[model samples]
Target: MSGQKACCHGPGYGTPLDAMKNGPREKLLYTVTVQPNLDEPHGDYLATVDVDPESPTYCQVIHRTFTNRTGDELHHSGWNACSSCYYIDDNAKQIPKRDKLILPSINSDFIYILDVITDPRKPTICKIIDGDVLKNHDVTAPHTTHCLADGNIMISTLGDAKGNAKGDFILFDTKNFDCVGTWTKGERKALCGYDFWYQPYFDVMVSTEWGAPRMFRRGFREEDLDDMTQYGCRLNFYKWSTHTLYQTIDLGTEGTAPLEVRFMHDPKRPEGYVGACMYSNIYYFKKKPDSDDFEAKKVIDIPAKLISVNGEKPKALNGMISDILLSLDDKYLYVNNWLHGDVRQYDITHPENPRLTGQVFLGGAICSDLKNVEVLEDKELKARPEPRYVKGRRLEAGPQMMQLSLDGKRLYISSSLYSPWDKQFYPKMIEKGGHIVQIDVDVVNGGMRLNEDFLVDFGKEPYGPTIPHEMRYPGGDCTSDIWLANDGK
Candidate 1:
């Protein structure tokens, strides 16, 4: 990957800081790093890093970097090679070390601040925040972070405490990285799990939580089998100024288990819509003009059985709907059924009622690799389980993360298990290798699907690992809302 020149221009080329500081000023490049579990050897935690795009070939690729409230730099480096830790000096020599800071557990929600760094090159350890701040606050384990339009940072906390499982939102001073204030949704313990995304166009942030009442029940055991009751998902609207919860909609009522919320601005739709995955249904909520509320207008139920390639009833589908994406043209919506191992496209000609127009199955009889491992001795474990097989269909691995090309012409799909912290905790699943399916999108056919022409073998890389969390488009416009400097220049 080193010899290939990045598609975008080299960093630090056109920025105003070109002549300011000493050598080249470093820009934060976020890349998710998976830290393999030494105990089970299969589970790993995903962490992010900031790298200087123009640094010499020999500079160390970073593990983590963040600035405290006081503007002090904090950094974490030096994980083992199996963990994919490496150095890139001017000579590009690969030196490996095990001294890197390893978190106490593999769950994604275990730590508050995993690692931080102020300087991209030669980063230093800054400060670690305590988790006690969430004792009675009903905040979740790991906080979802987003750098706001202002200099402040917004973190969404999922409430998994002894009380109600409902969640809250917190804001921090980016300069010092201190908790400034929080946005609570009344007094009910709401379960706001996983993540929240900001929709700047509407001046509001949106999040979805799987409302499971049993999660709040005492003595809840992992092995307990119970009816999965949908508590109804939430679409929270916040007033950016006061950091207050302005309005919310019960998304799960329209669709079961509304997990992911994505914002879309369409030229045809009077009000933009939020697409959500509710079990076997797809829902869309359109925003009210100049208001913090949305009208739940449309719900589309996916057909249970597609005429299989050989024309048979599709198998039972179970699992969380991981991600939903809209093409640049806003004509179609792509939904990934993680457990079902299928990616489908829907036509949104009528924004309120999208129709499932296309579908493709990449796997069958899905079983999580993380849930299959049995911890024998401290340093050893059993071989990962193979895909579950069923008549006329074999389980394909789950699709965990996906991203579209800027032009929206191609889709990149990845198959990996959930973070090690989830119920199933297989760590080394990535070592068995995963598949990257690239599909062409038909923009002309109301966002219909084109044939998949390429499948990249990521496992063949020299130090290949199990999971690849994100893809970085180097030298792009850097317009992501997380970037503090995105003026669209």
Candidate 2:
């Protein structure tokens, strides 16, 4: 399909490569910025940034649109429609365009829908899904949002209406943005939910676990690991068509708090990786060769660094593998160590054995040579590689969220993780505000370098210091777009 013809349908491109080759170049990006402090009641907002280097406002936030209320802690955002539901027949008229964006608040449980097509530079709030509405459907703490192939929307909620640690998926009609009740048929077997991905060809859907909202929203407590009800360390597999849980895999001690999950872009492949935050490990999973079961193995392990904490000497600090994603071509994998303050790229051509190819430091607590580090309730001394700088601005807060370009040439990253966790890990960075930077990819040779020419410092915004979370492009990005088996035709 020609690029021009593909743009007329939902999310356009028929395959990941097609999108990378023919998809439109990103000129603007919409990122969610949160006001972590409650005393300053200004509220979280969506920021519009000019990414076009040729523009006069290049590398600057051009506009900001706030959510309905304060203390929302806006986390992730996605489109209402994507290539998952590309129109194949005359029903193309009935299929919605890749326009509106669904932004969900992890703290307040509110979902804000924005009209991006109207003005890509400045998105306006078209509709807001109140927390009460989700509570009525027995779910809250809305997290990951993904467009379904059936012309509807599905979001993974961290808990039930009261936010008490139960994985329940909430559905909504894309056309009207109305709540369509829970996607789980009956009792949800999973204890927690954070990120999820589906592959219709395999008839499988995989989801990872996080902490209960009631506990996580307050802050991170090391003692919570002992309580099964407060934290989780398992992955749930479900039948995609029926949305029924069939199997559950316990990741044990080394896989505590499994967060992000990603499958290969190829529709026919059934392999992916999940990053375990607590233990700093990545597990690769795939279907059993001759059976109807799936198996996972620990393929990447990040060793802990010893640091002083609150006058105590020699304490092990986990890397806190916060986010992970695959390149559009599935040839490389990127991992972000929030606490260690570095991003590492791996060559995943062999799937099980991921070879570290490139690594670069941005902002992190342990990545510096300073003797004293000030985070909440801890004083540490570290002697590691000096932190890297861009355009004379010292990058603070380690890399958190990432979004890669379709063509696999550039990778964009944000620094803020979660507000509460950010307070515990990098409190000083919170006051200084979050930032967005670009990394030029060595796609051919497997490496990455900081694009010193580009930087979006949220600290400089007129709306006070804010922490930016997830980001999405006006025309679909590598993370937000998915292609079906028959989409290429």
By lDDT, who's the top model here? Answer: 2
lDDT of 2 by residue, 284-354 (tens): 99999876578988999898776676566667777799899998889999999888788899999999999
Query: Which lDDT value does model 1 have at 89?
Result: 27
Candidate 1 local lDDT, 391-482, one digit each (tens): 32232465555555545555656555333322242222445444455566665663434233344333433334434444332222111212
Each model's backbone clash number: 36, 0
Q: Give all candidates' CA lDDT scores.
A: 0.42, 0.84
CA error at residue 448 for candidate 2, angstroms: 1.0
Count steric clashes of candidate 1.
Answer: 36
Q: TM-scores across all candidates?
A: 0.59, 0.94
